[model samples]
Target: MVETGRIRVAKDKADLVKSLISTDGATGPFQTFADAIAFAAALGAKHNRRVPLGEISKREPSPIRLEYFASMGHDCVIKLLAITETKDIKILSLTEESEAKRNLIFEEYANGGLEILQNELRGAVDYSERILLMLCPEREQQEQQNEEFDLSKFLS
Candidate 1:
């Protein structure tokens, strides 16, 4: 504990994230999907850039996901994540969510924190595979008059 004019502060980000995720601790970035949507609409009223939100999926069994992006940024995120028992090589955007999604969390740590977390997850699994499936519900239509902004040009 560090003292600042008599007010003490935890010396680490992990400490902060730890306290927040604990039961009876502060509530997370979103309480529910509707709350998330409303926060997104308001450009993040409860959370900010400095704080990373720990969001648990609302699906039955409710797996936790550490959000790297802000509320409004979550608008482009694919909602439904398919958890499979086996890993398929043909998938993109596929990465281990965590050792166990239920009550899972990734806290900021000093000294190879991410490496430790990834290593922990690496050895603990064969548990489940998480995949992102694209859902473009729009019907096929003819090309419009608007100019297409091709991102491929930036790749080279």
Candidate 2:
């Protein structure tokens, strides 16, 4: 794949992203900004929301370099989301134009996911706990579906 520049989050969601990241003494669910972005992008893709970003602030919450995602093993997530969105395998082509398009799609989905997270996390004192709570229902549902194995017929 071609080298791209920085990946940007929606300006409006910058504060939300900050709250999700765990710093020196902070206790957030994500260890890095890239982790939070990947989560938001996945969330957006799950909800089928692709919101375009608005005016970005000049300072704070700096844009993440493309290399960070690759180093974090999130490069595949970008390519996967891009291919899924466009329903075109050609998006995987190793070219600058293709890479740019993939990044654009990923950013929009991440922005949308951030919006969803912002609404879900509102009025929360502990972000980590709140995120866990958000995940509980799905976990519970999966547990409920996991029935114990039965081998009664084998006894015949």
For all predicted structures, in order, the TM-scores are 0.17, 0.87
Query: How much RMSD separates candidate 2 from the native structure?
Result: 3.2
How high is the CA lDDT of each candidate model? 0.25, 0.85
Model 2, residue pairs in steric clash: none
Task: Give model 1's clash tally.
Answer: 0
In Å, residue 18's CA in model 1 sits off its true spot by 21
Per-residue accuracy of model 2 over 41-152 as CA lDDT, tens digit each: 9989989999877765345567788899989998888999999999999998988888888988988899999998999999988988888898899888776666444455
> Of the candidates shown, which would achieve the greatest TM-score relative to the real structure?
2
User: What lDDT tens digits, residue by residue, belong to model 1 across residues 40-140?
Assistant: 32222212211223332233212223242224353222221112212332222333332222111111111123222233334332211210010121111
Ten consecutive residues with minimal summed lDDT in candidate 1?
A: 130-139
Please list the residue runs of candidate 2 whose C-alpha ends up more than 4 Å from where it truly belongs after superposition: 1-3, 146-156
